[model samples]
Target: MKRESKLEFRLTYDDSKEIEAIVCIIPGGAEDMNSYIYIDDYLTRNYKVAVININYHCIGNRPHLGSSFYLDDIDKFILDTSLKAINLKCINVYDINSYENLNNTFIKIDQEIQKLKLNQQLHQNYKLKTHVSFLPFKNEYQN
Candidate 1:
């Protein structure tokens, strides 16, 4: 019997930002192999996005697959490559088992990214204000 594989994925991002990150989880089998193409195409047209592919072995008593040994390294490589390709800091990834719980996780990650972007904007604004405030003091001391 051909082994059956199931995969679940969630795409999330900071709604306020034009750039978005996506995480995908693939459990067992070679489902990731196929899904990635679709994702790549989808993101190419929209906001810049990166995808992390998590590969896991879910079959009973099966030996670890050759690809599993370097899962982390591969994930990092893909993420970096995607970052360059999309020119966006967002990244998304998933593990096979987490597919079932993706809904909640997706929402949580989206909120976190939004918060981070907001904080970064605020920091930039504060720095601008501080620089402007210091300009007059520097000029007075120079004279």
Candidate 2:
């Protein structure tokens, strides 16, 4: 039996407050420890950075089947991590699979942020009110 190990991950932040995180999933082997080391150094140099990793098992060697099936899981991980980074006030979140559909995701996120900002501004500037108005009914009863 092969040994189980942690995956390697790296996180870096720039002066502009953008956070970049990456996880290297080595196929058919355990996690790479250097990923964590690099992430640690990055975090030390830059504030508000997060890095994490997941292990992928070789086919016929572990409980899980293969890496292809884990694509959804990986995507969710990236989104969740990105959201967390955003909550931490990071300008951006970079991922390994960011090249895939990232532009669309970023656009959607930007729209939501804009909507929130607009709502906040409206709330601060205007008061909300509810009113009911009804027109007179025809003279059917009189007829």
Candidate 3:
């Protein structure tokens, strides 16, 4: 997230809101171009969430021509460093470019991830109602 860093990302957030989690967008390249500026602005202005567009370069000056294999590394790095969850279920899986559902999807993802973080921050006194069964918490119950 540093200015001189190779981690190319654009972040946006509302002043009244706290950054609960990060939404790392690994965009699909239909063309080889640096179009993340507009995409970042649009997502941030609308969602009021901290939206980041990770930039990757093709081998050449090709538009949208990088392999998913290479991109996966970047994706994993972002997931490992920027996110927190008590269980894998805390992450929201959604299609990034579905304009009709984009805003709602981000909003829902923000809420879900935030809940996971909150639960963890509150000493993670998780319960059956939350239904997260993978943890080693002593309080976990069985029905």
Candidate 4:
């Protein structure tokens, strides 16, 4: 039998200025085999946003397939942090489970956020004073 892995993550963000939104990244399966990968600090610095990636592991490679704690825990975090959105409404939660998918989603979300406002560059990366852009992406293939 395989042993469960420990939980860990790296959170990078700007607290000086209120960013547009907060991104919640919850990795499924093993903590070592992460499901997301942040490219650079461009999004956080330029956009003034917060990024949180929580990682945990079970006894199997596909722990998410048999457990609900990952989603459930992240959901609770969403609800708790939802109030942090001072400018906009609430936070944006991207339920991603793959590195490639996370990269694509980050770019798309960053591009979209930049397009949403006319003034893209505001004090480096400060875009909107609203809130974090919470985009929950569901894998259509999942049943």
Q: Which pairs of residues collide in candidate 4?
A: 20-131, 20-132, 21-131, 21-132, 22-132, 46-125, 87-130, 88-130, 92-134
Which tens-of-lDDT digit does each residue in 1-143 have in candidate 4? Answer: 33234455667787786967877766643433244554325567778688777654332334343322123345435533542332322334445444455456446545655654545432345543213222222211122
Model 4 weakest 10-residue run by lDDT: 134-143
Evaluate all candidate structures by whole-model CA lDDT and list the values in order: 0.39, 0.40, 0.44, 0.46
Per-model TM-score on C-alpha atoms: 0.22, 0.21, 0.30, 0.29
Q: Per-residue alpha-carbon lDDT of model 1 for 1-143, expressed as tens digits?
A: 22244433444343445665555545445353344556555654565665445533332222232211112334445544543453334544334123234345345545654565676733332211100011121112211
Name the weakest run of 10 consecutive residues (lDDT summed) in model 3.
Answer: 131-140
Worst 10 residues of 2 by lDDT: 134-143
Q: Which 10 successive residues of model 1 have the least lDDT summed?
A: 128-137
Candidate 4, lDDT over the whole model = 0.46
After aligning candidate 2 to the native by TM-score, how far in Å is the CA of 112 from where it should be? 0.5
| Cα shift from native, residue 22, model 1 (Å) | 3.5
Question: Candidate 1: where is the Cα deviation over 4 Å?
Answer: 1-19, 27-30, 58-143
Best by TM-score: 3
Give the C-alpha miss distance for residue 51 in model 3, angstroms: 1.0
lDDT against true structure, model 2: 0.40
Give one digit per residue, the lDDT tens place, for model 2 in 1-143.
Answer: 43344333333344455555543333334333343566555564666444443333222222232122122344545555655643423333333233344555556666655665576733333322212111112111110
Q: Give the total clashing residue pairs for model 4.
A: 9
Per-residue lDDT, model 1, residue 71, is 24
Alpha-carbon RMSD of each model: 25.5, 25.2, 21.1, 20.9
